[model samples]
Target: MRLSQPRVHPLTNDLTPEQAEVLAPLGQGGVIPAGPVLNIFRTLAHAPQALKAFLTWGNYILSKKNDLPAREREIVILRTGFLCRSGYEWTQHVEIGLRCGLTPDEIQMLKAGPDAGWSPADAALVRATDELHADQFISNETWTQLLTHFSQKQAMDVVFTAGQYTQVSMILNTFGVQLDPGQTLDPDLRVG
Candidate 1:
C-alpha cells in the first residue's frame, strides 16, 4: 500500500549497499524494497542475535499451546493492532484473524470496543487486553470471566501474548512502518 505519512526513519537510502542487500530478503519483494520506512527494521536486522531472538519469541506466541484459544489470541492481537495503529501488524493479522474464525463484523467491532455485541468470553479477552495495555492490570470481574473460558495457565499466557503484541504495535507504529507494496490494509479499520 502507498504510505500516507512520511517515514519516521528512512533506512533504505541511508544504508551501505552491502548492508541493505543483506537485510532485503527478509522483507517482501525479494530485495530490500526501496521505501522511506522499513529502513529502521532493516537496520535492526543487522544485529542477527537480537533479530533471531525477537522472531523466535514472536513465533512462540503464535505456535505455542497457550491457555487462550487461537481465536482469543487473534482477538487481542487485532484489538491491539487497531489501538496502536500499526499498519503492518494490522494488515498482516487481519487476514490471519479471519482465517482463525473472527467474522468481519466482529473484527470491525473491535475498533469500537470489546463489548460491542461480543460474547462474554470474547469481550473479556478484549477487556483484558485494554486493561493490561492501559492500566497494566485486569480487574477481578474481567479476570473471573476470562477464567471461565481459559485455564489458569492460559490466563498467564494471555498476559504475555498481549504484552508481546503491544510491544510490536508500539515499535511498528512509532517507527512509521508501512505495509509492503502489494499488501492491503485490514478491512474496515477506523484510524485517527
Candidate 2:
C-alpha cells in the first residue's frame, strides 16, 4: 500500500498548549509535535463531552490502565494500524510499541498477519483482531485459542482496543493527519 506523507507545519507553541503539555510526559522529544487536532480541541474551548468520552476510551486502551499488559495493548494497536494502512497510527504507535517491548520485527510481522512465526498466543491475538476488523467477527478456532491464553476481560479489551485503533486509522487516513515535523518515523515500517 502507498503511504501518504503529509506536510507538517513547523513546530510551534502556538497550537493547543494544553494537549502539548499533556503529551510532554510521553517523551516526544519535540520532534513530532501535536498537530491541528489540538487547535480543534482548544477551539471547542472546553473538552467536548463527546471528545472527552473518546479520549477516555483511548487513554484506557493506550495505557492499558484498564488492566491489559502494555505489550498486548501495543500488539492490538500495531496490528490495527497495519491492517487499516493508517500511516499516522502506525508511525505513532511504532515508537510506543518498541518501548512496550515489541521489536521492530514483531511489529513488521503484524503486516504478515498472525502466521508469521509468532508464538501461538501472539499469533492468535493478531489473527483474531485482523479477522474481526476485516470480517467483523473472528473464526471459532481463533476465538478458542485466544481464550486459552487471555482472560475473558483481556479478550474483551483486545477486541475493543482493535476497534478503537481501527476508528483512529480511518480518521487519520481520511483527514490526512501528518507526522509531526522532525518526528522520527518508525524505521521498521516500510514506506511505499
Candidate 3:
C-alpha cells in the first residue's frame, strides 16, 4: 500500500440515489458485496460517470468477447499488477487467476518473469507485458514471437489487458486501496 489510509475511503452505505443507480450492477437491491471489488466500486462511485465508463470497457476485457483466453488474459493482468507493485490488484487477481486455471506455483513464477521457464507462448505473453511496462510498447521481436502462438486479435488483447491492468494497478496503488480481507500480500510486493 502506498499510503497508510485510503485517499478516498470506500462508501459502505447511505449512497445517494444517483450513486445507488450507478452502482446497481455490483449487487442486488443496492447492496454491494464485501471485497476488493466493492471497495474499488465505492471509491469510484465518487465519480459515477467515470466509474460507469470504466465498467463498460472493463467488462469487455474480462468477458469472453475478449480475444484472449481467460487464463492468458489473467497472465497479463497478474504480470502487470506485479510489475506495478499494486498489492490490491495483485491480491484480487491471484484469486481470479486461479479460477482461470493458474496454479499458485505459476503465479509465483510470474514474479520471476519471462525467463522463468514458461512455455514459448507464456513466455511471449510475459515478455510482451514487460516490454509494455518498461517501454510502453512491445518490441518487434516479442511481437513476432507472440504471433507464432497467438492470433493477431489475441496479441492485441495482450496489449489491451496489460494497459488496462496497468491503469488499475496505478489506481489501486495511488488511491491506497488496501488489501481485501483474507488476502495475503506477496512479500515481494511489500514496499519499504
Consecutive 10-residue window with the lowest summed lDDT within model 2: 38-47
The candidate scoring highest on lDDT is 3
**TM accuracy, model 2:** 0.74
Per candidate, the number of residue pairs that clash is 3, 0, 0
Worst 10-residue stretch by lDDT in candidate 3? 27-36
Q: Which residue ranges in model 3 land beyond 4 Å of their true spot?
A: 27-37
> Over the stretch 107-133, how does candidate 3's per-residue lDDT look in tens digits?
999999999989999999999999999
| lDDT for position 155 in model 1 | 80
Error of 2 at 143 (Å): 1.0
Q: Give the lDDT of residue 74 in candidate 2.
A: 85
Query: What C-alpha lDDT values do all the predictions have?
Result: 0.72, 0.69, 0.87
Q: Tell me the alpha-carbon RMSD of every candidate.
A: 5.0, 5.1, 2.7
Please, what are the lDDT tens digits per residue for candidate 2 over residues 92-187? 778788888999888788888888999988998898888888898988898899899988888888888888988877666655556654555555
Model 1 lDDT tens row, 76-104: 98888777667777777777888779898
Q: Which stretches of candidate 2 lie over 4 Å from their true place?
A: 1-49, 184-192
lDDT of candidate model 1 versus the reference: 0.72
TM-score of each: 0.76, 0.74, 0.93
For candidate 2, the lDDT comes to 0.69
